[model samples]
Target: MSVLVYTENWDGKFKKLSFELVSYAGKLAEMLGTTVTAVSIGSVDQAELQKLGNYGAQKILHVTGPNLDKLDNQVFSSMIVQAASKEDASVVLLSNNNSGKAIAPRISVKLNAGLVSAVIKLPVSLNPFTVVKKVFSGKAFTNVVIKTDTRVLTLSQNSFELIETGNKATIENFNPEIDTGLFKTSVKDVEKVTGKILLTDAEIVVSGGRGMKSPDNWGPIEELADILGAATACSRPVSDEGWRPHGEHTGQTGKIIAPDLYIACGISGAIQHLAGISSSKYIVAINTDKDAPIFEAADYGIVGDALKVLPELIEAVKEVKSS
Candidate 1:
């Protein structure tokens, strides 16, 4: 038996998230004294498929087929289950991103295995199958134990460090026997957001809230983000107020991101908003109220009007960069 990791690619290229998942799986497999197998679906090149080896994938399975560009839950789960069976995988690992969240449950049912999401670290113990994850809005930790023989886990983004093993993976063109009749819908074309840093993959993020006063005042936040080469995000209310797009909203009910640095400007740090960004490595808060809930969670905080403070912050960043 081995550890199998499912990797996702964007436009025939693997994202850092895919590498992180493989790296986590590799470390886990090492702890268990097993090999690591990575599965990639789509039209990823052989050279691109081999990149998983840098993170410790001993074997890479590349699957290609018609209409593979579109993601089908049944097709994805079936392929993953079939790949796991071929590898006799004792554990299955994937990213805790949108696609992973959608397919992990179905794979668990197919394998009759216990599943865990947002796993932060390698298993603490193997005997009881113990894993760690944050709970209560990242204020508390919980140890979960899976009793099933086969296990499925979704690794939280940015929670684990990446490692290169300097070993090359054996790439094999994998063809899983799946029912073609499962393809009920066909996507004729795709539209992708270009020239923008995806919040999920961004290491640094700059977020604004209603405290910015109006969408017109978002200039400083965008400038800060551009200077830092970071993604831009917004609190839920900002989106609801039509000050920002819904895609940029981040909270318990919106996208969950764990970037290296999260700068919150004019945000009150509501519990719902904190839940999504609580896993960030460092948090910086700027608000007029020193007692704002955002300050309590921030590594660095500036108590002032965001409109007044943002310009200074932008200039400071520019100076640092110029220096």
Candidate 2:
């Protein structure tokens, strides 16, 4: 039996999370005394596919066919299940992101595998195969034991480090029977926010909140993000007010993120907002109010007007970069 990781690609390029999954799967495979295999869908560069070797995939099963370019949860899940069966995968790994969230559960049901999502670490004990996972919006953790022989797990982003093994991986074509009917829903077109770090994958993120006051006031926030090479995000109320896109919102009702550094500007620390970013390695909060709830969760708290403070922060970062 082998450990199989589903490597999802976006616009023909693999995201950092995919590499992280491969590395994590490779380590687990070593612990389990099994080889690691990667299953990828759609079109990706041969060189890019080969790079999986550095992260510890011994083999890659690439599935390419018509209507596979777009993401259809049912179709993608079917493809993964078929590949896993062919590889005799005893353990399957996935990234607990948007696509993985959609496809993992379906694959689990089809394969009769016990699934654990939002897994934070490798199994503490493999005999019983107990894994730790985040619960209650990442405020707490729970250890879950998988009793099934076939197990599937979705790793939370930023929870694992990527290690290069320098081993070359062989690629094989995997053609699975496709139900043309699954293509009932097809992607007509795709829109992407180019030239910006995706929030989910960003190492550093600078976020704004209602405290920015108005959409026009976002110049400072964006400037700070640009200086730091960080992705820009906002709190729920900022999105609800149309100052920022809903996709940029981070809170219980928006996207969950765990970046290396998260800078919150003018946002009051509401529990909902904290739930989304509590996992960040370091948090910096800037607000005029000294007693804002966010200060309680912040690693570093600054009591100042964000509009005045952000420009100074940006200048300081620029000076450091120049020096």
Q: Clashes per prediction?
A: 0, 1
Candidate 2 per-residue lDDT, tens place, 1-323, comes to 99999999887888889999999999999999999999999988889999898899999999887777788999899989999999999999999999889989999999999999999888998979899998899789999999999999999999999999999999999899888887667677878789989999999999999888999999988888888889999999999999899999998889999999999999998999999999999999999999899999999989999999998999999999999
Q: Over 4 Å off in model 2, which ranges? A: none
Question: What are the lDDT figures for the candidates, one per model?
Answer: 0.93, 0.93
RMSD of 2: 1.1
Q: Estimate candidate 1's alpha-carbon lDDT, on a 0 to 1 scale.
A: 0.93
**TM-score, one value per model:** 0.97, 0.97
Clashing pairs in 2: 269-294
Model 2 Cα displacement at 293 (Å)? Answer: 1.9
Candidate 2 is scored at a TM of: 0.97
